[model samples]
Target: MKTDDLISMLAAGNPAPPRAPSARRFALALFCGLLGALLLMACLFGVRKDLAEVAATPLFWAKVALPAALVLGALWASGRLARPGVAVGARWAAIGVPVALVWGASLVLLAALPAGDRLAQVLGTTWRTCPLNIALLSVPAFIAVLWAIRGLAPTRLRLAGAAGGLLAGALATLVYCLHCPEMAVPFWGVWYVLGMALPTFAGWLLGPRWLRW
Candidate 1:
């Protein structure tokens, strides 16, 4: 058969179906991960006793917002990275902006306090466990988000993996807020970020192996 005839036959009645939007896949993945995190948190430490009271407080939402913002930014970055040949561009800035804001707030808060009080604010009662808990909670989400990314077309495995991992960490950190008692900005600026970083760095390290298409 002629080339034109062959091409026409190949393009005939079996039209390709539309693919699901990446946002929907990511949303489902994130929701699953959040559920897993919630279940894990409930079993491991349970939500804080005064959660209802704290929920009414502005500081509580502020704490929740930090990771929520990172989640939004990382979602944008990860979605771009999951597609082949896509430039991450300004989308990546979404991740850093929240960290910068928290760090800035932390610095101002620390500077305003007396030196002795500053250390306590930064260290909080749960300083040692905060990051560990956040990282631990991120495990489920990390698995979920990476699974979602892997099912798609991610060209830059390392970057895509890192973005996915950050998304997981930010999401888990958001859930962590429900259980975490510490509300100090300094504590969040330091430990909460560190918790999220653990998974992001892990993704970078494992990207080649884990995210390989």
Candidate 2:
């Protein structure tokens, strides 16, 4: 066959390789997160016997719910971005960076208010507590998710990394809320933002190269 004719025949006959395994990737992410949570709990339990008391509070439930919801949303968003021929960079930045910044800011603000103030009262006494909590719990989960999705052959690794970081931050915040009592808004606005946002950004920047399978 002529070379051009042969090329055309092959192109017509063959299909593209399937992208990375989505289901397996998601499963791995979830598993890694859960493992991290368990490890966090174990470590915390050893350090602070009273950690159970914090876990029993309604705030803890709120923490878990919010982050879980965010994770689900992120998974959906990530899947959409993963589609072929999309401008992954633009889509990821448009969605991921702002969401992460706003989310981190809000959490910090919520943490900083005095416990008796309506918002603060609702959230708890120690705003910084949440970031610490999240750093311990959700960071692992985020790492897991990144690891699972690392095989995708996308050019925008930085964007993917940032998205992954945001997902991790959300999950960590959720777990953090379980143990935190809430605090002044200002306290949270600064400290919490630094704690959560910095790590997330770092993760996003590093994910593409480091997390790749």
Candidate 3:
């Protein structure tokens, strides 16, 4: 074949190279996940001693599962949005906001109810610590989780972040539970949710801008 013809054929057969995944981005996500977990655990320990013990329980595993489900759901949503050329910032907000609201509201309502109700006892214990613990640990936790998600390769970031939040929250909550003695479903439903959701929301809002490569 003529040289010109051969060049055209080669160009047609070989498509553009795929973009490489960013190592820096993945590192950022991992760092955020680890740091957030550490900070959250520290807050829980500072407020209540019993929480340290609770952190070791099987029940704690169950609690973490709930958030993991939420995270996976969010990741799936992110993937769908990406296909349509959605901005990363917008996609994070679009998916993160609703999850945070629902999670937060559920926690508030659960906490507001009377703990003496029979149903509350069967789930787990709730010990009241200063709200300050929530403020310190949960808020940061959310930020880290969001940062971790942002670092994920576009295809997996959303879902992975969500799952990471759930796992992190569950671990944090387990620690919180060690010190709490309320043992009511509603109480935990509320306070634990707040602890997990607040930080996640913060991360969602801040991570895109701060962690972006």
Candidate 4:
């Protein structure tokens, strides 16, 4: 057979791969992870007693918004990374911008506060518990998201793992807002990032071992 004709014949023999499998798996993972995080939060901490009042406050939304933005970026990066040779590209920016904004807000607030009060704001009342709670809450998401990633083909296991971990961490953080009373930007900038970091680091460490397929 002629080279071009042979190539055409081989191409015609294989159907194009389906496009939506990645989307479906990720969507399902997001739903399940979020539900699990919510349940864990409710069972473990209970919703903060003043949720109704707090929900009306802008700071509450700001807390929710920060992680929500990371979730979007991480989800995108994870989905793309699940497929071999896909570049993460602007998705890195998506995850980074929210964190940058939160930190910037925190610095501004710190600058405006009295020096003595600055320590209290950064520490908050629950600095010790906040990140710990976030990391604890990330357990369900960590499992669900990594499972989702493993089901697909990921060439860069560590990055894909980190992305999956971040997605879970962000989802957990979003749910955590319901129970976390610390509304200070400095608190979120410090503890919230640390909380999410635990899972992300774990995923990066485990991706090669866990995600090999």
Candidate 2 error regions (>4 Å): 1-20, 45-63, 81-84, 87-124, 183-196, 211-213
lDDT of 2 at 100: 63
| lDDT, candidate 4, 8-114, per-residue tens | 54477622123487688888888888899999998999999999998998878988999989999899889888765568886699989999999999999999989
Q: Which stretches of candidate 1 lie over 4 Å from their true place?
A: 1-21
In model 4, where do residues sit more than 4 Å from their true spots? 1-17
Question: Best candidate, TM-score-wise?
Answer: 4
Q: How does each model score on TM-score?
A: 0.89, 0.60, 0.44, 0.91
Instruction: Please give the distance, in angstroms, between residue 47's alpha carbon in candidate 2 and its true position after superposition.
Output: 12
Better of 1 and 3 by TM-score: 1
For model 3 the TM-score comes to: 0.44
Error of 1 at 145 (Å): 0.6
The weakest ten consecutive residues by lDDT in model 3 span 14-23
lDDT of 3 by residue, 64-165 (tens): 444454444444443332221234455455445645654574566566767665345434433244233544544444555444444332333333444444
lDDT scores in order: 0.85, 0.56, 0.46, 0.86
All models, RMSD in angstroms:
5.4, 7.2, 9.6, 5.2
Q: Which candidate number maximizes lDDT?
A: 4
Cα deviation at 82, candidate 2, in Å, is 4.8
lDDT of 2 by residue, 103-151 (tens): 6756665567565664543344555365666566666877786765564
Error of 3 at 83 (Å): 8.3
